[model samples]
Target: MEMIYRPLLPATQYCPCNWQSDSTSLHSLPQSKHASSFLRTLIAPYAPLWVNSTPATTDNSSDDLECPQANINYRSAFEQQKREAAKKMDATTLMMSLYVPKGRWQWTYQVPFENRPEEDPVTSNRIWSLSVRTARIYNESITYICKLYPREVQWEGFFSEVKLHKTQLRPLHGASTPALIGIQSNITGIQLAYDIPHHSFWIQASPDMPDILKRRCLDAYHQLHAQGVLHGNVDLANILIGGDGRVQIINFHKSRSTKNDPKVHLGLATPQDFNMEMREVHYKLNYLGAREKERAVWENRRNSRQTPSRRTTRRRDKDPYAIPMEPPTDPVRWLIPDNWKPKRFIVPGQSREQFEYHLRQFLLDLEKSKIHSPSEGDKSQGPNRRPPGDRSPPPTRCDLGKRKRGEVDSEDDDDDDDDDDDDDNSSSKRVRFLAQTNHDDGSKGKVRSPPPPGVKRQVPRISREYQNFGESPKTFAIPFISS
Candidate 1:
């Protein structure tokens, strides 16, 4: 056989070596600094030539020359490992970021079965199952007890039932059934998420509960029945007893509309039909021997109320307006203070000027009462003075217009009927009343001239018919002012 020479492996491959024998040597190496450091750590356990104290020879001289070349090989392998690790870390981070974030109104989660409580009744149920998960929403941490269905058809049916409950029954008041938030499905099964109520089931019999609780439960059943929902599963587990002693019926998956037959039956009847059975049970528990007598009496009374005699019908027809009438008085009149007098009404034949004078006097009296004190003498005596007697002539047409415009600056001796300059406050009040009454006249009441600055123009108080009553040929009776 021909002798063949096999090139020996480099020492750096089998044993650790200071690839950077000198600072200049390391800088001159083609491999990167990171690759060099990685290769050092990977071969840390291998004994170096310096540690072994091996003698230098011709065979070892070849190993020294090959060290840089071996380092390049090691560096490539190290870089490949780092690249794979970084790719795996980036993939894991991206998966974690894809999870659904929390929300305001509602939230959901895919929880594992291992998360459920070991002793929960849901874990023991055979026909139906549930998985528990926590959801933070609406500023509350709600523990969602999601119902799990095995088959696709079963999940579809449950979803339909919940949708019906949400749309048809949720809008009705006192329908205290737990609301469905959303549905989730996966390889394991389908889950129906509902807002979990923090309450235990109302397990006690109707007779065992207090009269109030019994009535409330009965009322809830009635309401559910009236809404056409038949709580097909009304067992102790389905009835929830709230912390505040409220009773809520839940688990509508087995429930049915009055118009449809239930998919599953647990011997529970529709609310309307169930009421009669409940009544009998209640009578048997509490009224014992008086059931028949009480039923007979109730039937007799109901029949009597339902059937009206011919004579009674005739009487009702003869007096169709027999409803009781309330007295004509202001409902809020009693809320007024006792010291406040009723508003003064105009006398039957009172003239417009007389009514105005009386109104001014009333307002002045109110002002005096507000400022009056035992120590203060009457300050009613001033430049704006009213005549002591009613003998003073009524206001003329020109004086009324001048007063309305706030042009009466001084006491006019020429016109005895003119009011004092201080009467401007009273004139403004009269103008407000006129504006209110004349509002229906539209453009007819619009002011042609603007009043002077700081002066409010008087609005006509009388209606269109009364605007030119003095010029009309016919005499019209003044409208009555009722108390």
Candidate 2:
């Protein structure tokens, strides 16, 4: 309950408009164990001083095999690695169809998701360092990870609009997944980057791979709700294992089609890139506000892509329990702390409208030796803007860092940010989340929103920014079903 994270400095100067200004080119995705000089920089740029946990890696035996004795488990060694990924992608697309080699697919050692370089877990001291992405798969890839899943569930019943019941026939219901008619891009079509691999998991390659790996995320969430369409970006990195029993659910971008009945893939273009990753997990758990906006927008978009996320750090990256400032009350992903503080502004060539808020208040006082060390009754509940020394960092490992805030009534809706809803629909009665939704005396129900649950409400300005890039960034939807 002390949130305010903003740590990312890959050699400073600032970098996120997209990152990747050709740093010796970029390469490390073809099977990626993780080294090419640690991907070139920020493997885990001190994972934002812990921010409430997620930097503990001692994990080795997900079956353990480094290279031979093929017992298998990365979901059946990924279903014989997806039938040998179509025979090694048909002999490497027939040896790149005999082409010479022009950026081959743009692999010039492209560093910057914080410098990179962190894939060493075979011998002993084990080092992962965090910083993931590359999970593409239909063609061959798998490593995508953005972080900030501090919690999930209840973005209005996980993609709400009142049980989603759009009918006209509901796009004729699941025509085979794909929608995005009409394209317009101020850029950002996957290039926010990562060419694809949004998700893929069917694994069968063997030794029971984590019980058939979550049975392919509950059989792709019951096969996208039996194809009426509403997978609305399921979770655990959109679920993936793809090798044989192919239990998959790769990103339809945001997938909807509950019943307008055009047969399913209405037209297809991107629907705003599948509603920005199914509404960016409903604004980082909006109902809980994306569990602290995925921990302050991935620590401010990966610390503004510490030089385009080139990421780096030797050992001491610390995850003592990451406590940045927000997320930890646990009533299902806590988020009403109310301490905000830094909201000054003025970035135009940095004449310094307070010099980036005193360099973010001297990195929030050098992040008090880095917190997230919480536990002993959460350090007698003492740490606030987190500084006074070791108060958290001891959770993330296996359960994968602080997760439980899931099962709510209904709370997942998207489109996200750039919003500004005033709301007053004449006594209101809108529930249009289309998938099957039909309550209010109709059928599928659940509707109530009053800051009740154990009571603790305050967080109102969920978002607001005006650095003036020509001005325009307000976003506020908040509509997932109520009356």
Judging by TM-score against the true structure, name the best candidate: 1
Top lDDT model = 1
User: Which segments of candidate 1 are over 4 A away from where they belong?
Assistant: 1-119, 122-125, 130-141, 152-160, 172-175, 199-207, 259-483
- Writing each residue's lDDT as its tens digit, candidate 1 over 1-483 gives 222222222212322333333321222323445443222222122221112235577666775666553335778889999998887666544432333222222233332223222212343254457544543433334455577676434343464465455554564323466555555544445556654443211122232333334444555666676666666554434554442345566566666665553433322345445454334333422322224434444565656633222354322123211111111122222122333211111112223333333333333443453454221232223223343454456788998898676655445444543354335455654464333334555643533444789998766454466766779899887674443
> lDDT (0-100) at residue 189 of candidate 2?
14
TM-score of 2: 0.18
lDDT of 1 at 217: 57
Give the least accurate 10-residue stretch of model 1, judged by summed lDDT: 320-329
Score residue 30 of candidate 2 by CA lDDT.
Answer: 32
TM-score of each: 0.32, 0.18
Per-model clash counts, in order, read 1, 128
